[model samples]
Target: MKSTISLLLAAVTSLVVGGIVVTTPAPASAASLTEVANFGDNPGGMRMHVYAPDSRPANPAIVVAMHGCGGSGPGFYSGSEFASAADRHGFVVIYPSAQQEAGFGKCFDTWSAAAKRRGGGSDPVSITSMVTYVQQRYGGDPNRVYATGSSSGGMMTNHLLALYPDVFKAGAAFMGVPFDCFANAADYPPGSSRCTGGGGANRTPQQWGDSVRQVYPGYTGPRPRVQLWHGTNDTLVPYALLQEAIEQWTDVFGLSQTPTSTDTPQTGWNRRRYADSSGTTRVEAYSVQGAGHSLPSAGMAARAVAFFGLDGTGTTTTTTTTTTTQPGTGACKVTSTVNAWNSGLTESITITNTGGTAVNGWALVFPLPSGQSITSGWNATYSPSSGQVTARDATYNAAIPPNGSIDIGFQASHDGTTAKPSSFTLNGLLCATT
Candidate 1:
C-alpha cells in the first residue's frame, strides 16, 4: 500500500531527502535507493529501489511493484512489507517511483492514449526496460517476472499486463480502473459516478478485450494470469469496476463470464476463481467485504507470492538424491515434458501409481537448472529453493489408486537456455524422467 497523499502534494521539481528522491510527498525511509534519470521518454525521470535477500538465489524471481498517485516508492516499500517478504522468500523486488509531471500528483499517466498503446509511449516501455535492466544486472528470472500496484499504479499494472503479456506471467491489480478507462488526460481520475458506470458501459466483453488485443496485434500466445483485489467499500475506485475488470480479462483469456468456482477462504473475503476446461486457474478475484480504499496488509502480498510459487525460504542451494524403487514396491513413475518454450518455459509432469496399492498422497522432488525458476503452477503446491523444486499434490488430487495418474503443470522462466531435469524422485524413490 503506497502512502496516499492529498492532491496538493504535487510538485514541479524532484525532491531529494536523505538520498531518497521523490516527485510528490517525501517518503518515510530512504534505503538502497537508485535513480534512473531520463527514464524512457518521460522527462520527469523515475526512481528505483531494490529489496534483495541476504543471499540471492540463482535466477531469482523479480517483482516490479508500483506506487499509487502522490506516493513514493519508499513509502510503498515500507507500507507494503514487500522487502520483508523478499527477505523471507529469496526473491528480488523493484519499486519504480512515479512523479508528478502530469498534474496528477506523481500518478502514472494511465489515462493517456500513449499509455494504452504498446511501445507507443514512455511509461510502459520504461517499465519494461526497468524489468530487463534488473534481470540482466541482478540475475532475475526473465520468465517468472510479475507486476502489481494500487490505485493509479494498479491501472498501470493492467496496462503492462495487457501490453506486455509475454513479459509477465501474472499480475495483481488493487482498486484500479479498467484498461483504457479514459481517452484523455483531462478526464483523469474519473469521478465515482463515472468509474462505477463502467469503462466500457456499452461494449461487450469481447470488445473490451479487443482493445487489449489491438495493443499487441497478431499476438496469439498465452495471456498472463490475473488477480484482482478490491475493497467493497472503496469510494475512490468504486467496487463495481471489479466486475468490468473481470469481464475484460475473461474475454482476454477466452473464458466464460461465469466463474468456475467461488469460495470464502476466510471471513470477510470472497474469492472467485476462473479456470479453463482443464481446470487451470487463469484468473482470481478477492473482495474484502467491509474494507475500503486500502491494501490488505494481512495476507495479500503473501498470497500473491504463494500464487506466484516463490514462498519457499532461503537462498542456499541444496541437493538430495534417492535410490531407485524395487520392482515389488508401490512406486510412482514420473514423466516430464516441455509443453512450450520461449522467453519462459511451460512444462507438464504426469505421475502414475504403478504399484499394487493405493497411495494416500505424493510429492515430487527434482532439480531445476541454474537459470530456471517457477513463476506459476496449477494442480500442485510448488516450492522452489535455489536449484531444487518440490511439488506436492493439492488436496483434491492427493489420493491415487493403483494405475491412477495425475497431471501437474507449471510455467517457468529461463535465461534463454532451457534444460529439462534428468531425473525425478517421488516420496524418496527414484522415478524415471523422460
Candidate 2:
C-alpha cells in the first residue's frame, strides 16, 4: 500500500494503489460445500485449494483463515470450530496452506519484504487473491472480509492489516504477533512481512513501522477494528512485550488506561481490564499466570464470531463484569496533517494519555465538519454522523501505558485543508497539539 511517498494529496492516494477490488462473494444459500479453486501457482507453480461454504449468496462476507508455520487448515481448523459456523452463518471460510520452507511444511516468508526483498511473497495477497476468486465466482461483501491465523499466521494477520487496509473490516489475532511486535530495517520491505526485527541480522531489514504508518483504512467507511487474545503464559510471546503493544495502541487512541487495584485471580489466570471510552471493545489481558503456550479455551474462535456479528454461542461466558470507569485528563492540543489524495487526506494525529494510570482499549471520537469527511484511518477508528462523532479501538491502537505517546494516521477527504478539524477530543477528552 506504501507504493509512493509524497507530502500532498499524492501521499495519501498511495494508500489504495495496491488494493485489489474484486467481486464480492456469493450470498449464503448457493454453494454448500468445501470447494477449492486453482489460484494459479503456489510460489513453485503449484495450485492451491480454497474452501468455500455451501449456500453462498451474492454479496456474502468472506473470511480467510491461515495456519501457523508447519501447520495447515486441518491442523488448526477443528480447533477453531469455524466450519460449522461458516455453514450456518452463510459466510465463506478459506483455509490456505503454507509452503514447505527448506523441506519443512511450516513457513511463510514474512520477513522477506521487511528484509528488503521484493514486496512479493506476500501470503496475505495470495489470500486476498483467493478472496477475489471467490468474489468473481460469487458476489460477496467487499467490506466485511476478515482474517485470522495461528502463531506465524497471526503475525500474517497483522501484516495484512499493515499492508492491506481496505481489505478487512475486523480481525481476531490469537496468541500470535501483537501490534508493533516487529521493528527492524533490511528485514521487511513495503507491503510484505510484519516481523522485521525478529528476522535477525542476516540482511538489512525494511521498516514495517513506516509501512504501518502508510497503509491502513483507506476511506473505507471507517478504520478496521480487531479483537486480540493472548495467554499470559504464552512462552512464545512475552506478556510484558504484549503489554507494550497494547499500550502503544491505547496511546494512539488516547483512551484512559489504568491498572485497577482490583485484580481477579482464578486458579491459573489473572485478568485485567482495559476498557475503551465507548465501552464496547474491551482489552483483557488473560495472563495464564500458570498456563503455557495455549489459548484460554478457543478464545480466538469465539472472538472471531463475536466480531463478525455472528451467533457467539458456547463462546462468551454468562457472567458480565462491570466495566471500570476511567478518569480522563484535561483537554490537550490536537494537530492534524493530511496527505491528500484519493478524495481524502492522510491524517496524522498525536494524543496524550493524561489519565492517572494509562489508557487502554480506547478510541478517538472527533466531529467531522461538513465539506470534509473521514474516508478511513489507522490505529484509531472514525465513524462520523451529521455532527456527532463516534469511533473506537483499531487493531493496532488498543493500549496506551502511562506517559506513553502513539501516533495514528489514515486517509480522509476535505474540500481544502482549512476544513479539517483543528483539534479533536479522543474518547470524550480534548487533546490539542503542542
Candidate 3:
C-alpha cells in the first residue's frame, strides 16, 4: 500500500551535513518507492519506503538502511545505493523516514534515554514494526535480516542492534556514535564537541558495554554481529569514537578487550575482527583513513552483505597473491611498535614480504615482557602460549605480494612498566626490529 504523510514535511525543510544544515533536492526514485503510513502505533508518525528488487529469492533477505539527519527515506535509497545492492543481491531494502517531529532534523532520537530502552519509545517500536511488516508482507527471512546506515542513521543502527537484537542478525554502523554514548540529546546535541569528538568521555569499556546491556535488560538471546566503520578524518564524527565503539562491542560480545585479528585488507582501510570461541567473527571494526564524514562508496555494502552471509550464491571471493616460503625463513620481515601509557598499552606489528615472490601464508611470533599480557588483537589470529604471542594471518590477509605489508594491532593491560619486545620472528625466522 502507498500512503503519504505530508503533514510532517513542513518541519523537515533542511538536511543536516556534519554540523551544517543545507537543503537537498527531493529524491527522484519515486517510481519504485512505496510509502508506509502506519507501522504499529508509530507515535512519531514516521514513514518508510520499501524498495523491491527486480527479482527476489525464495526467501529474501531484508536490509533496513537509515538515513542521516535531514535525509528522507527515499533519499537514502539513492544516497546509499542500497537499492542497487538489493537488486543485485535479491533482497528487499527498507528505508525508514525519521520525521522532524522526532527532533534533530529527521534524525532518529538515538541520544534519548527513552530511545535507548527496548520497547520503550516510538523509534524502536516503529522500526521493529517495519521488520515484522516486511517479514509478513514481503517474504523477508527473519533470520537473514540486517541493518546499515550513515551518521544519525548509523546511530540508529546501533540503537536497533541493542534494543532489538533478536530482530536483526547483524548490523553495520558508519560514522555513528556508540549506543547510549549520551544520556540525552541536550547533553551532547548534534555537532557539539561531545557528539563529534572521537574519544570516550571517561567511560570504561565495561561501562560503555553496560550501556547497551541495560537497554535490553534480562533478555539473553543470540546477540547480533556488529560491524563498525568510521572515517579517520571525519570532523562530524571523530575517528577516536571508533576505538570507543570497538570497546563497547567487545564488551557486548563478551570478547576480550583486545581484537582477535587486525589487518589492512586494503591500503588505507584497516579492519579488526573479534571472534567467538567457535572461530566465528562476532564483531568487526574498520578505520577508513583520510576519509572525512562520508560513506565508503564501494566496499561498505559488499562487505556488509558478505558479513551477513546474505550474498547470493552463498560464497564470496577475496583476491590475494601467494608465494612459497620455507618455514622459519624466506621473504617475510616483521616490525613491531608499541604505545603504552600508565596501565593501558597498544601494539602494531607490520609484516612485509621482502622477497620477489609473494608469501602465501605467514605468522609472526614474539615474546611479551613479564608484566604485559595480550588482551585482544586484530587482522591476525592472536594466541599467547608460554609467555610468547603468535599471530597468524586471517583468510583475507594471508597472501602478501613482494614488498606488500600487512599490519595488525592489539590492546593489552600493563603493570605501569614499559616493556618492549626486542626481536620478532616471521615463520620462525628472526627479524630485525626497526
Please report the candidate that would top lDDT against the real structure: 3
Instruction: Return the TM-score for each candidate structure.
Output: 0.64, 0.52, 0.65
Highest TM-score against the true fold, candidate: 3
lDDT of 1 by residue, 365-415 (tens): 666767888999989988753354768779899888999889998888888
Query: Against the unseen true structure, what C-alpha lDDT does each candidate score?
Result: 0.68, 0.49, 0.70
User: For model 3, how big is the CA root-mean-square deviation?
Assistant: 15.9
lDDT of 2 by residue, 1-434 (tens): 32321231231112111110111112223543353657642442222444556655677787877655455554444444455457545677777766635112344445544322223444555666777776776676887788776555666665665566567766665555544444542333322333322332122113323345444423334435554555665544444444544453344334345633223332233455454544544334445444333442322353366565554332222134543322222333445665666455666777666555666555454545556666666676665532334455665766676666677765666665435553354433435444
Off by over 4 Å in 2: 1-37, 40-48, 55-57, 100-105, 114-121, 179-211, 215-221, 251-289, 312-434
Error of 3 at 375 (Å): 52
Two-way TM-score contest, 1 vs 3, winner = 3
Better of 2 and 3 by lDDT: 3
Kindly report which residue stretches of model 1 are placed more than 4 angstroms away from their true locations once superposed. 1-44, 101-104, 192-202, 312-434
Ranking by TM-score: 3, 1, 2
Error of 3 at 82 (Å): 1.6
Of 2 and 3, the candidate ahead on TM-score is: 3
lDDT (Cα, tens digit) per residue for candidate 3, span 225-305: 898998887765677787788888889888886666676654456777787777778888888877666663433565677
